[model samples]
Target: MTLAQRTPAEEAPAGASYPDLRWFPPGTHITVRGLKKAFDGNPVYVGFDIDLPKGKIVSVFGPNGCGKSTFINMVAGLLPIDAGQILFEGKTIAETRIGYVFQNYREALFPWLRAIDNIHYPLRLMGIGKAERERRIEELVAGFDLKFDLHRYPYQMSGGQQQTVSIMRSLVIEPEVLFLDEPFSALDYEMTLIMRDQLQKVLVARGVTTVLVSHDLEEAVYLADKVLMLTRRPSRIADYMDVDLPRPRDPSTLTDPRFIDLKARTLEVFQNAVRAS
Candidate 1:
């Protein structure tokens, strides 16, 4: 049977079946049902379920080794799950269009290709013609308000610039979902701040369903509409807190009482998760 036809029992994880059909919350964009994974005989996730909302940014933060990157990778279909099903708006991964921005910009971009060419590569793979590829690239360049030249090779550009290209490449496809795994971790403090602002503008404007995995607490709360915090191994949701802070959040937002309080709360949950581990 096709994925869409599968019953709730069929969608359940191995050895753990449920009769009730999984109910997605309103505006849910992605659904993960009974997700299970293991490596070297050690279980990471077992019977995990989550409903990610449409047109919003959800940041995944947790204690170290709590499977933040693992979660997104599995959802993005980069890594295989041992069992269970992940669907995008009731469609399987093959039927979904996705974009991923890896944390390591230096390794993610093509050293030989010009920045513009890197952005065009995915479209080419999708059988998009040269004319359309050029049009999309032009649109993204304009949307990003790019100041630097795109003709330069990745090796010649600064770290922040390379990451910018990586983001643009992911976005060029206009994917239904965008997964970013620590996209700014390598940049210096000054550059990280700038990239955050740039990313926020494009993502909010496009309203793509985005899942970001970050190690930094402040960065996680600053950029997210909701923060999904996980517990230690055999990870479970510690808290899925809504970030009600108004956006176009600037550096000044850091000092806002609400922002500060939310960050403190997130940190507290994180510390408790760690201690429990």
Candidate 2:
């Protein structure tokens, strides 16, 4: 239970603790105990327990509608947990500083606002001063190597640019935990690769605990320190794979024997879940 405070871009007070996660040990930033959820008498999750580690990326993958998004949404408080608890130490979900990047970038963006404004929107809501907001957004843009102009409206940008804006919006707050729901699903293969690298870079620099939902096997392994594979109805974590690939990953990483083996093993887990269902 000794995580260091996650300071923001040159602005957090000297020696201030980031209360969002500093109290928890590295391996249990968010603990879900006996979690359960259902809709109309049908269960999605039952008696599920998992520990989301501090400052590490955990990717969740499973068959469609197997409650991956539902799980994270419950954790994020977008929806209520039917039972059990999701907690950061003793804090409620809302007490934590959380950043969420939804799967649909276009829908999430403010059409009338410039990309920069959209990214700055959340900070403004939190009452962050203009100068401090600029510093944080600037850090995110520079860290991600975003080259696109942010003055344009969301409708004027391409899918990738819009998503990049969405990502920056999530990161501007320097959240203690970040939730990404199929963040790259809208991009093409090349753009997906580019976005993945950008995400990894910022994550490394920020050291935020992250939970990602990805459908792509390669992507799950590429971005995660560990992959949580889910089962069908009455959803549960069917298996877990710790990805040990070297950092600063590239296309070449996909070819490494280690990466290949990890993907194959994860794919097998999903395949078995399918058969069992």
List runs of model 2 lying over 4 Å from the truth: 1-26
Off by over 4 Å in 1: 1-22
| Stretch of 10 with least lDDT, candidate 1 | 1-10
What's the residue-level lDDT of 223 in candidate 2? 94
Question: Candidate 2 lDDT (Cα, whole model)?
Answer: 0.87
TM-score of each predicted structure versus truth: 0.92, 0.89
Q: State the lDDT of candidate 2 residue by residue for 79-153, as single tens digits.
A: 988788788755888899899999999899999999999988999999999999898887777787867799999
Leading candidate by lDDT = 1
Q: Global lDDT of each model?
A: 0.93, 0.87
Candidate 1 achieves a global lDDT of: 0.93
lDDT of candidate 1 over 1-277, digit per residue (tens): 3454355555666766444454667699999988999989899999898899999999999998999999999999999999988999889988999999999999999998999899999999999999989988888888897779999999999999999999999999999999999999999999999999999999999999999999999999999999999999999999999999998999999999999999999999999999986
